[model samples]
Target: MSIEQRVTEEMKVAMRAKDKVRLIALKGIRAAFIEALKEDGSESLADDRATTILRRLAKQRRESIEAYEQGSRADLAALERAELEVIDAFLPSLADEETTRAWVEEAIASTGASSPGDMGRVMGALMSAHRGDLDGKLANRLVRELLGS
Candidate 1:
């Protein structure tokens, strides 16, 4: 089944199981998917689009968690972490450090990126190659390390 279909099914399962956190996250995902479909005039989102949406949701949750922690709101931080866990259930397998490093090397080679000056080109290639499988911030860090900048 497609990612969209799987998410819909998961939403129903969450409802049946009375999983409040999962249900809320699923609803948010469904709403985002619907909004994207409406905006693009498409019946279903492509896999890449779905992955992108999930990643964006996860990123937002992480940011919220960080902010909550900074504000000394543990309860809100916990909630954001729960939501992040639910959203992460649909994401592609995250790349490990070794894999990320390998991809960074490949990106550098493929883009002929020799110095920090080519960081943008290298980052663009890496993001395109590893989207949904790697976190953008982590990827950027790895690229920077590889470029020694």
Candidate 2:
């Protein structure tokens, strides 16, 4: 089944189990999917689009967690952490730093990015090839390290 369908089914399960954090995260996901459908004027969301939405949601939660922690709000950070866990369940596992480093090296070689000035080209290549799999910050750092050497 598609990610969207799986999410809907899981939402029902969460409701039945009275999982507050999962239910809240799923509700937010469903709402986001509904908004995307409305915007696209489609009956359902494509899995790729749904994945993109999930990634965005996950990123927001991570940022919130960081902010809450920085402000010395452990309770809020914990809540965001719980929400992030729920969101992560639906996302594909991200590439590790080593894998991303390999990809960065390949991107540099393929793009002929010999210096830091060509970082944009290398980054664009990496994003197009591995948009959802790689961590942007990690890939960027790898790119800089490879190109700067």
Over the stretch 16-121, how does candidate 2's per-residue lDDT look in tens digits? 9999988998999999999999999999899889999999999999999999999999999999999889889999999999999989988888998888899999
Error of 2 at 51 (Å): 0.8
Off by over 4 Å in 2: none
Per-model TM values vs. the true structure: 0.91, 0.96
Model 1, poorest ten-residue lDDT window?
128-137
For this target, which candidate reaches the highest TM-score against the unseen true structure? 2
**Residue-level lDDT tens digits of model 1 in 5-77:** 9999999999999999889989999999999999999988998899889888988999999999999999999
Compared with the true structure, the alpha-carbon lDDT of candidate 1 equals 0.90
Candidate 1 similarity to native, TM-score: 0.91
Model 1 residue 128 CA deviation in Å: 3.0
Residue-level error in angstroms, candidate 1, position 119: 1.2
